[model samples]
Target: MKLKNLRYSCRHCNTEVGSIPFASAEEVIRELQRAEEGNGEHFLEYDDNGSMTVRCICEQCEQSLRMNPDYYALRKWIQ
Candidate 1:
């Protein structure tokens, strides 16, 4: 399964765009389920379908998102 987004907005840069992200619905569901279960502590917002709906910026944006694993877990808790 492949996950593609027709539109996305960068979480940091707010750049809205149509882009094809790393494709894998199985991976996404697994990751989401993991996070939702509070068992996964890695953050790859770009690696998921919901977040992929927002365009991921370039390597420069990597700095901003790299430290958010805990935040991701918190988000899952809230969700």
Candidate 2:
């Protein structure tokens, strides 16, 4: 059996938060497909090696966003 990998990184800063090894992609695909309608593309990505990279916000970025809610108006907030 082949192992599947799921890498989580911060969308704003590209900081790698963590990774998990999955027995199969089935579970991950199912969960990602359940994402809000057409917005699934924003969260899921397949790398060159076929591994999945899940775009997510890290703690630092999340805190920054909370401190500066206006940053949400910009497409890329980190400056």
Best by TM-score: 2
What's the C-alpha lDDT at position 46 in model 1?
42
TM-score of 1: 0.29
- Model 1 steric clash pairs: 8-55, 9-54, 9-55
**What lDDT does model 1 reach?**
0.46
**Candidate 1, residue 75: how far the Cα is off, in Å:** 16
Report the poorest 10 consecutive residues by lDDT, candidate 1.
70-79
Q: Which ranges of candidate 1 are over 4 A from the true structure?
A: 1-9, 16-23, 39-57, 63-79
* Tens-digit lDDT string for candidate 1 (1-79): 3445334445555555444344535465455546645743332344455444433454545554575555544423222
Tens-digit per-residue lDDT, 6-78, candidate 2: 7889999999998877664568755865783578788887766657788999999999999999999999877
Mark the regions of model 2 whose C-alpha exceeds 4 Å error after superposition: 1-3, 24-26
Q: What's the TM-score of every candidate structure? A: 0.29, 0.81
